[model samples]
Each structure stands twice: as C-alpha cells, then as structure tokens.
Target: MFESIKYLQKGNQKRAYQAISELDIMKHLAAYNPILCGTLPIGIDIACSDLDIIMEVDEFERFEEQVRELYGNQQNFKVKKLHIRENPVIKANFWFSGFEFELFGQALPVKEQNAYLHMVIEDAVMKRHPSIKKEVIELKEKGWKTEPAFCKVLQLEEGDPYKELINYGKNTGFI
Candidate 1:
C-alpha cells in the first residue's frame, strides 16, 4: 500500500507529492525499494516534518556512492553510516523542492524497518482513535518526535517508546 506516492497527491500531502516528483526520488532509488515513512504519511506532521524515505540496501558503499552522485550538489547534502538498534544503516539527507528529504537504507526489507513499522502502527492507531491525531500533532509541535508522541498519548510510559509502540502494535494486532 505504501509503494507509490499517489496517495500523497490528495489532501494536505500535495506539497510532498510535488516535492518527491520534482526530485524523482522513487525513480532514482528504485533499485533499493524505497518506501516513504514517518509522520507525514500518517498525517501527524508538523511544519518541520520531513520526507522520510526508507529502503532495502545490501551494499552500503554502492548506496552511499549513488546517493552522493545523485544528491551531492543539493543544498546541505550529507551522507553517513550509522547503527540503529545494532543494525548498520546508511543515511543521506538534503534539501530539495522546498522540503527536507531523509533517505535511509539498511539490509533489512523496507516493510520491516522501524520507521516503516512505526508509521504503520501509528496509522492504525490514528484510524482506530481518530481524535489522537490532533494530540499527536500537538506533541510533535511541542518538540516530541513521532514515536514518543504516540507513546505519551497512549500512556505507554514504560521502556523505550519505540519498542513499546511496536509491542503495542503487535498485541493489538496492528502490525
């Protein structure tokens, strides 16, 4: 369901659609199976929300090289390798078409990535409890990141908010 940016063309996501299309993000990263994730897709975004694209990548070197070659000249372009939850990941960030884009890659499938899973879970929660959208957005506006905002709104105060939310999704059959 997250395969294309067509859904972004409607409602408040039009700007994201224009930005992604203008930059040809999906086409450029097609080899990696990029999937857009995060608050924007689920509609809890604040003004600072970014276009977060996650991908499955087997070769960090090749991914980094391609990202650099493709977006190297973009304003504030930066790429680096880092570990998240013990998994090595390559991340590239830059400004394009009036939006900030964050491209993340790891060896795992895009659907299994934390960002994608979190977004899926958040979307499920928002759908079940429609009113929480405003609360999540309010928390985000107050400097809380997406996962933590959901945790706070749901009163999931124990453990890592990230993992907790995932567990919540699992228990609630949202994952």
Candidate 2:
C-alpha cells in the first residue's frame, strides 16, 4: 500500500516497511501505535544515527517480554532505561535479519514529542541549504551532534539552535 509513497532515501522504503511491520505486530500484541521519526526520512542519516521512534504506549514491560520471546535473551538486544522530565522512557537497540532497530518508547502526549518537532525543523533547514546534508554527514562522522552540526552549517546562532530552527520552520511554513 505504501508503494505509491515515495521515500527520500534509497533504502528507506524497505526499512520503513520493516518498521511498520514491527509496529503492526506490536499493536496486535500490545495495542500501541508507534511512529517513526528521524533523519532517515529526509535522507541525511549518519552512521551513528538511530531510527528515532516515539510511542504513547505504557506497556513497555509487556513489549519487552514479547521482544525477548521473539528475539531471544537480553544479551542479543540491549535496553537502557532513562527518564525525561521525570517520565520514563525505554531505549532499545536490537538487530533482526541484519537490520538494526533503535526504538524509544514512552507514554507522552503527541504535542509534546520533541523528536518529531526537531525532525521537522531540521528538514526545513536542510531544504534551504541542500549542501547541509553532506556537511551533516561529515559532522556526524566526526562525532558531532546533528542539531549543532545543522546549526553550524546553517549559521543559526542567535541562541538555541533547536529553537531557532523551529522558528525558521514556522516562519517558512515548513512545519
């Protein structure tokens, strides 16, 4: 059904299919709708980049159990527990059929999803400076964060680059 939807990246369609399949399985198993967000959608992903995902599901323990049963053992897949603004988040890294999955699960409201907001702004900035994608890839290779790399390339230094980029997106109607 997604064949008509053109993906910006070369292999993103396949990756997206796999991610959606997993999410479908999760929804069937745990009833959660997880959305994929990150640089891959805009075709500027770096080697160190993760497939940033967000979900409003609070059934992480059940989800973990299902993952463990499907993938076998915690050693094969690593999970890190963290808190954001006092709310719990589960960060996980796992591989299936050579495709690495980096998933972040939480129960936050849709409007409060910062990752999605950041992606929108970064995409707007990259659209303006087409060459910034290459610069961002180079910066990521040099171990720099994506946001700061984008800011440096775009010359948005009036304060927080993240907020500045968001404002640019809003002003330009890219958001």
TM-score of each model, in listed order: 0.98, 0.70
Model 2: residues with Cα > 4 Å off, grouped in runs: 1-30, 72-75, 157-174
lDDT of 2 by residue, 41-125 (tens): 6677765456555656577787667555754442358877789757888767776544566667777753356666777777777
Residue 63 lDDT in candidate 1: 90
Please give the distance, in angstroms, between residue 98's alpha carbon in candidate 1 and its true position after superposition.
Answer: 1.8
The lDDT for every candidate, in the order shown, is 0.92, 0.64
Model 1 TM: 0.98
Report the Cα lDDT for residue 128, model 1. 96
How many steric overlaps are in each model, in order? 0, 0
Clashing pairs in 2: none
Q: What's model 2's lDDT at 90?
A: 76
